[model samples]
Target: MTIPGHDQSSYRLRLEWGPTGADAVRADYAVVVDVLSFTTTLSVAVERGIEVFPFRWRDARAAEHAMRHAATLAVGRFEALSRGDARHVSLSPASLAEVEGVERLVLPSPNGSSIAFALADAGSSVVGACLRNAAAVARWLAPRVADGASVVVVPAGERWYDDTLRPAAEDLWGAGAVLDALLHGLGVDAAASPEARLAIAAWRAADLPGDLLDCAGGRELSGAGFVADVEIAGQHDVSEVVPVLVGESFRDAATLPPDGPRLRRVGA
Candidate 1:
């Protein structure tokens, strides 16, 4: 199903927002962006060699899912803290960076994670993208796109008080960061749609670090005392890990065999 006039299907590279927008674009690969947290944390997890399971909600189902996978379930900012559980890792990238001995984790985030699930459900090869790993992700995609594959970068925006999409600035910048890396940074020959061009422009014209901290999502995280995570998001191209969703988990794509195939299932 495609949205008339909105789906950037005319171009090999496209950019959109959230799950609905992902459906509209419908590309071979989908890059999910959530700068303030989800993708940022995902990069850190993959960098640490931890498999991450993206769940849509942090509810009873998430806990059960984690148990079924024999993975640790991540809780909200203060939920695990209040419960006095030692494994207190939230969506914050900082929290995940400090964690140890965890091989697998279930990250339940409705916005970014939900969009990732939607894209995966639609059978697109999904990868989480943020400023930290944008260059690496772009490098991976460059060869594939040059070989005639298509891609859509989806910025998972935040929700408003009324539950509507807020089109958060941080997410836009994150998407733009990926686009910038692909087009100008890596010089990928993939033709970009207008939506994609907009993203590239946003990234090229931004002030960085300062712009990210002043964004709405940054302020929100800062107000919630997770300013460190926002600071982490402000960074650009510091990681080579690209977390690709294979089956149900996001694993480091760089670790796979040449040409990227089969995340090993030897444990089972």
Candidate 2:
């Protein structure tokens, strides 16, 4: 139910691995990182004024969820090419570059999407993050973290063929990117857990934009003709948009009213 003895509760900034870790170290806020795509695509979508709904799967439920919101349901990367529509959206951040005439979209994946959905379901104010907007996310959180908001950053790692977590380095870098900005950027000096410090180190160790191209996840996507997506995900701090989950959809934090209500776990 919670971390055995590695509780990071006292720290204002924290880091965790997946859904279970998220629930274990549940805080007043959560940051979901999935740089190979999910959050990268989310950055693109939110920048375009599109509302994104995170779904745990890309099956029938996604279709129904999309329909219920009058939104388009994203298809698989390869499936999008076959859709014959130039605007067909997929998990590929590159594919969403030219999307138009759409407002709401159901974006789903087994990793980050599931994590974001679950964290929100558990009543944590969730923010979708990737390498591209790490600094901006950190800047947004700095003031709040200064005001006593505890954050649990979740790096949604990939799953292996046997369904075990792969602990992908890219996601660690993604989370580290945010933690690094928060610690070194605005002079907030929020208390960071040992786990969060590790992430910050990983972010510094990364070579960025170039190192990601050769990372395992990058090679996998490049080999599959989705290299552009990897490239987009690799760009650091290039976006000013911060996608915060409002109710069930991710909206640009800047666009919402300053006094908007925040979701909080019942007894957390």
Candidate 3:
């Protein structure tokens, strides 16, 4: 299973889309991406006190229905906000929180939700890796590979390109950096090369406070008004909560406090 134009020996990094890609994910590791902020936003919201329920972008009505009856906060975006849409809020976690009396969050985004549904059953652990959680996810994944486990780093690519989304280039690059660090024993400084350096320079020029917002995804997120979420997600080695998909929903594997925020139990 060697993907052309990528390193074939170390591990496989494949870019795919549509139903064919979605079908293939059932037997491989799937890292869903929607770097502009849906995945990042979901990670942040779940880290906070909010619960997330992801659905197909076309299933907006179902998400809205869930929000109305289940106290869920419907979060989505296409172009504009619809009128009299009480349950649906902007994809921003901050904006979603502004709505009064909402509980769980139902999210439908252009890329993230589609990727999630596609890769729902590929990896032993379907983890969401973004630039925000790059280091953390890399650290978490490093030890696992020592067991000779097969891993696939799936980037949620744009609808048009097989390459991962530009905003998600950080994750793809970061994943490669992590693998290089683990296998070839490279340090973070060594990891920061042409692209990484350019990313850092961009971050500094933008007056961004941290390295999280420096990536392609971070810039898109900044425009989307979820810059804070990107900052929080970008923090390295913070929460141990690596959300893994079980059946159809995600569960936090990190040993957080009992009262800590978490996603809804798939069965409970």
Candidate 4:
């Protein structure tokens, strides 16, 4: 189950809207991307030692109830935070924390949690990925592939009215480029698409720290006062932690020892 692009025979692509589509996805390795910042923020929080709990769009109230009773902090979009009128934290990592004893973060985002729930159901193992955690995800995923395991990269896009747009196309382009590099050992195909080519050019031209500040998602976070988190998220391969959904809780994949004797987990 190596990364998809490395072996074309084990790769397949699928497009979906929100968490509801999780049932349709069937893969061993799942990569969920919400480039606008949901997945980005989640990765940052988890890497910082915060626990993330994803809730369905329809089950937000239940999530809030569980959060309150469990004394866990709730973090999610204001729109889908609750069913009746309950409030939940916004999707800003700055608003969250890097402290201990803050148990349970009930997260529901337009793109992030919805996609997360879906992937958790369909994927044998679901991992969160964003531009901020791109290199880390690639390094973590590269050698995790089993002999014939299937992998799916679900990019949580934004919604307009009732329709959703692919999480910034630039995110998908950038992530795809990284995956291509790690798994396939191939540089992004400049001929793939104009948008992809441009992203690759920008990625190669500028230093990572500088380029992250200028990317579309980076600018959005900067404008939202989360520029620092964006910077932290953009640091490549800084942490060896790969977040995985375990039941109702999320934990770092690095904590689990490798199952077989052959493949060893690489990063911390």
Candidate 5:
């Protein structure tokens, strides 16, 4: 509920890319966008009625988290392909589509999961949004933000070799896609940063399917033999499921309260 030195006058619907940006915002809710393809994958799984629990790292802890919830562990793309089971899911959105008989899954990602975890750790409400369900997420959030209550749309960008952040075009577009629906479509009276306005402009100008396929994140997924995943991520405004994080698990936003309870900070 608080971020040190949070200037409420600056913006209501703020836009930020990367973990550091997320840390700078003081918001009632944090909507995370990671188009290549963590959030995209969540959108797909939520659509298919699978519960997703986000883990910050793909390690023993992640496996244990899944076990604790009686959920299956989603692996990395390379490992999933090596296993080659129809039920094997991973970071790839396409792979999740083929999985069956699993009601819940633990997905670990370097960017999206980490941001979601941080936001939850800070006791902020969290929602996962992407091109596929931007409009739905906007609709879900519009009525929930009370007057003067802030919301930050965070685009989880890729990490550079030196462990710094890289501004990803796909994430910008994804963040913008949600903002477009949230501000314009839903007609929320929210302020925006210059960077946010720029992102909104980019989203409006983008050809979506064509442009997303050419972006760095899209190309990387394609080159990794996950072309289908790229295509899945590019389908704009197609999904209705809004993945909301509640109690360490993501469920359909419709199943949650209109405005869910905020988390408490650790040891608070």
Candidate 6:
């Protein structure tokens, strides 16, 4: 199961970027990191008991999907404000924290949600990973790495204005945060790709929480007056909830009762 140019060994515990990366690696488990907002927001929502559905984009069907699930369709910050719907703001992590009584949410993002949908469609066990729950995700996944199984960590990087992939530092560090825990804490003898190694090194060299604030994604979001969101996204290892993708949405991994379709092993 080796991709032509990619080393098969690296598939064990690899780190890759964007949706293309998620498509390239076939793993038993996938941890998607989009720290700037999508995943960070998902982490917060799941922590507050909200089930989040990752939609590839914000389209007309978004409203319909929300209606089908009896969930709220989150709008962009400006859209929310313009519509006088301040209660359920866009992808801002802080805004999501303040939301209540919403059992489900349809969260659309070009980066994070696209990757999530791609991985889920591929039948991979997907989990939303962020700085807040990196270590916890690792701990939850440690024992699941049975022999011959691989885990792919996809950092859902931002899209440039022109729609090209922008390898974001926030996502790299976020993936690295989880990589550090998975590799060290699990003590698994897994092969890591060059990108994976670089991520781990970056995490080791960085003042994680502080560096996250200064990353390009952080600065951009903070400049837009979501400074609190940036700060909230940078909080390290504070959340114990592992947002696992089950059915069409993400719920806390701990709550995914073990009786059925339990985190299916890759290809099982």
User: Best by TM-score, which number?
Assistant: 2
Query: Each prediction's Cα lDDT score?
Result: 0.84, 0.87, 0.49, 0.56, 0.83, 0.83
User: Clashes in model 3: which pairs?
Assistant: 28-122, 132-233, 132-234
Q: Which regions of candidate 5 are displaced past 4 Å?
A: 1-9, 262-268
lDDT digits (tens) for residues 12-76 of candidate 2: 78998987788888788899999988999999999888999999965678888899999999887
Off by over 4 Å in 6: 1-3, 7-10, 81-84, 259-268
For residues 62-170, what per-residue lDDT tens digits would candidate 1 score against the true structure?
8889999999988876675577665687777888999999999999887888888776776678889999999999998888888777888999998888988889778
Mind giving the per-residue lDDT tens digits that candidate 4 earns over 135-188? Answer: 666666555543434455665656666574534654554456455544445322
Give lDDT for model 6: 0.83
Writing each residue's lDDT as its tens digit, candidate 3 over 141-214 gives 45544433334455454444663433444444434433443434423222223322443333334332354477
Tell me the number of clashing residue pairs for each predicted model: 0, 0, 3, 7, 0, 0
* Number of the top-ranking candidate, with lDDT as the measure: 2
lDDT of 5 by residue, 1-268 (tens): 3355553336777777777778776567789999998999999999999999988865668877888999998888878888876667788898878877879989999899888988877777899999999999988778765355667889998988998998888888899988888789888887777767888998988987988888887788788788999999999999999998998888997877755656432234
Better of 3 and 5 by TM-score: 5
Position 261, candidate 4: lDDT: 19
* Candidate 1 pairs with clashing backbones: none
Question: Candidate 4 — which residues are off by over 4 angstroms?
Answer: 1-25, 57-59, 62-65, 68-71, 76-90, 97-100, 184-216, 260-268
Off by over 4 Å in 3: 1-28, 64-73, 77-89, 96-103, 121-124, 160-168, 171-238, 255-268
- Alpha-carbon RMSD to native, per candidate: 4.1, 1.5, 7.5, 7.1, 2.7, 2.1
What value does the lDDT take at residue 210 in candidate 1? Answer: 90
The model with the greater lDDT, 1 or 4, is 1
- Winner on lDDT (3 vs 6): 6
